[model samples]
Target: MSRGTRAPRAVRAAAVALALAAGTVVAAPPAGACACGGLVDGPAYDTSVSSETAVLQWDGTTQTVLLELDALSNAPEVGLILPTPAPAEVALADPEVFRELDALTAPRAVVSDHRWWPELGFGSGSDGAGGAAGVAVLGEVRLGPLDVTTLGASDAGSLGAWLTERGFQLPETIQTALAPYVQDGWSFVAARLAPEEAATFDGTLQPLRVTFPSSSLVYPMRMSAVADDTQSTRTYVLADHRVDRVDPTAEAYEPTVRFAGRVDPATVESAELAALLRAGGFVTSHEQVFTEPGTEIVSDFVFAPAAADVAYTPTYSVVADRRIGPFFAGPVLAFAGVLALAVLVIWSGRRRRAPAPTLAPRPAGA
Candidate 1:
């Protein structure tokens, strides 16, 4: 669900890229306020491929980003990118964490009335390798086949030129797609496969976990326009408060939210995550899925955590404007109550309308 996100131009929410086709462009980046650059191959790489799905977990101080990307093409090299609000500490994360989280936060199906006659069943469910002339180094590390480099650049033009100069191939559209970020002055990361590990990649990329200091949980997605394919992401926010979308003023911004109840203490695996959930009953979960249409991508998923002093008040899942319950009976019961009240009102009105019985017979007798 999380793609917080980058480009062939950057390693955004994890935006690394590789060549898709001879004419394709690629980019990597995930940040706020902009400032990006790249070579001509930059745009082609950025546009070539899209991450099918991602899982994001944020507990205020730490953000764990995990993604499942298709296995790489049999190319000589593949590039990865990640962009963050602050310098990030990254390492390989367990892929199982994502599978567990996905199952944990999926939208629940409700069967309000289970009739005895039938049994109904329902179910649901980067780094960098940055190198260039005039590029200021930020950080660099290697995880698996990726050689990561993080850096800062003055503008997209220079960043573009640098990426091209550093032996990174560029697509024709790289410049136009990356202008805004370069203008916004954001930092980027570049990741490439180690030569020895290149051809042997099994198509399935291992999930990577990145943690950085951000005032709140925010996923940078401004550079997604470089890709020609549809983009989709699911974000799981584990904090006291609910999570939502940023830059609401944008006409096309919309995402669905679900309150994935408190983590049962017995079920949690990570001691640290469990401790965070155990300390306060206020600890709860929220998930938002962005099904962004294949248009110019905008907005970032913004998650706001619960205050340390407050406790959680449960709210059901939201799809569009509808709210599904903590256990699925809430709305059903409310509707039944409304129906009962309407029936009572109609009965009372009927009784009142019946004219009082006349005493005409008694009066005649008198």
Candidate 2:
């Protein structure tokens, strides 16, 4: 009992208009090269002298990072290595580069993630009043208050161990404890007491705050998922190059994406889904379609280009109950068809009655 293909002509016209608008061409980025910096370091554990901050390098740029470890007092060893097996279509994997990352952090905690904020004209707390905006990291951790300046190797190790241990537990259990409280792109400072520290009398220990550098780059992307009649969407945006925000709730979604190459129009599936949307009683202000064209940017790969931009004022309404106006011509066409049939029947009858005699008289006069 599905009423299909009933979208008004106006709706189809609006969709076409959107397609025309997005038709404007755009410049494409170099293909197959990570236009955005790729990963340089890893999932490896750092075991060496711990210091204030560690530095990791990628693309000749150093990223200062910090780790919250386990054990308040143990043989002070801190290691910071970038995780490995980089994403496909990008070449960021270099074990040697990660080793160099380890060498740099032995003397310091990687503070790059926390320190780079000021350069964007966003000033940190140290700057006097009326300074640029600043974001705090490891400020007040669940373990306790953390200080970024004085955080040492021992503190980093304690925090790391605590997180690692929790991760090792049952996956579901781990998620249960953290899922409700965790936010993507969120950084936290965590620590655990060493065996000796654990042996001490039960008491709360002070948390250490740490400072790390942050990148200015932010990329946000949107993707949708549908199951049966219900639909869901998720967005991934780089909070900084190092941090990403993932929002599951259907809220605002806009990601400042790095302008990669334009994809081909052929790659875009079809407007059928969009048509289905209209039939399902959803109205967008505009509709457009795109396709992927043939161009070898890489081996067996091509990007899908946008066909056009859609300008739409959203209107969500029920379609089943909409009333057709009297001025609508559909009913008029049905009425006219009936009237024409009646007129043809009447005219045929009159012609049959008079035609035979008229034909005989005309023949005689001739």
Candidate 3:
């Protein structure tokens, strides 16, 4: 139940207190409005050679989102398209918990280290200004020069038209492949540009690619803030789970663990414990059995490393059925000791009785 994104209680409380601390004051609306919600209307720039870039900064008081169009080899008509504020999605390490900082103006403040330029909408299209029929929605709003070819209500089509009209070209092969998804996936699609070559005023757009693990892998989604820093970074890792080797009870069990701090998985040593179990005729596999402190390990006998730095106290449940044999040497030696004692006592009593019998014969002869 706690697996989803949850905001820290203290963080949520502070956010509420901060909101209450600020007195409610309404400000005037932004300068000019565009059909795609809130649009910034300005002179059209001939950005044929450079890429378009928008930089947004949000302080406690105001949010400033700046758009820069680079005039490179082929310039297209560029516009900042803002839809009526849709719900913003913020990813958290734990999805179940909702944090308040994310709910507020944080989206307006993309971290400097992780700075990114998102796609804004178009200037007035085919029928001039205020035409609800054609509005450009540039999908992948990254470093690359967007090629807008369609002018319609949807941001994707309009952005495409804007790019094509200006001299930007889309490969027929890629266009054909994306034709089916033009309606749905286009909104989530944007081209990636090289990070090192990206600039605020350059028309040359860079391409970016991100890879995520498949669902079957057990991975950790971690988020933490550095000292004296306002931004937090979230990272995901695919690590093999292991049990505590010293504790025989936990040898075969593996559980996913979360640490308040960072842990280096490369230095972990549970391979030896797995080897020991194999020696005892047990097979081991890396499958998550529980959401506990240690890594998940499945085996016949207990499996864990001899020395491990345990991050949390864990409870292990093991159901073991073993056969005990009568040939055990300790019990056999104990039974032999008792039998020798009985034989010694019988011999002492017999010697005492035999002497009495001889004495009785002597008395009769006398």
Mark the regions of model 3 whose C-alpha exceeds 4 Å error after superposition. Answer: 1-159, 185-366
Q: Roughly what TM-score does model 1 have, to 2 decimal places?
A: 0.59
TM-scores for all candidates?
A: 0.59, 0.21, 0.19
Q: Higher-TM-score candidate among 2 and 3? A: 2
Best-to-worst ranking by TM-score: 1, 2, 3
What is the Cα-based lDDT of residue 41 in candidate 2?
Answer: 11
Model 1: per-residue Cα lDDT over 104-138, one tens digit each: 65555544433222225796402234444545677
Cα deviation at 193, candidate 1, in Å, is 1.5
Candidates 1 and 3, the one with greater TM-score: 1
User: Which scores greater on lDDT, model 1 or model 3?
Assistant: 1
* Candidate 1 C-alpha error for residue 219, in Å: 0.7
List runs of model 2 lying over 4 Å from the truth.
1-137, 141-157, 160-213, 218-335, 351-366
Candidate 3 structure, TM-score to reference: 0.19
What is the C-alpha local distance difference test score of each model? 0.45, 0.20, 0.23
Q: Please list the residue runs of candidate 1 whose C-alpha ends up more than 4 Å from where it truly belongs after superposition.
A: 1-64, 71-75, 109-133, 249-251, 270-296, 305-366
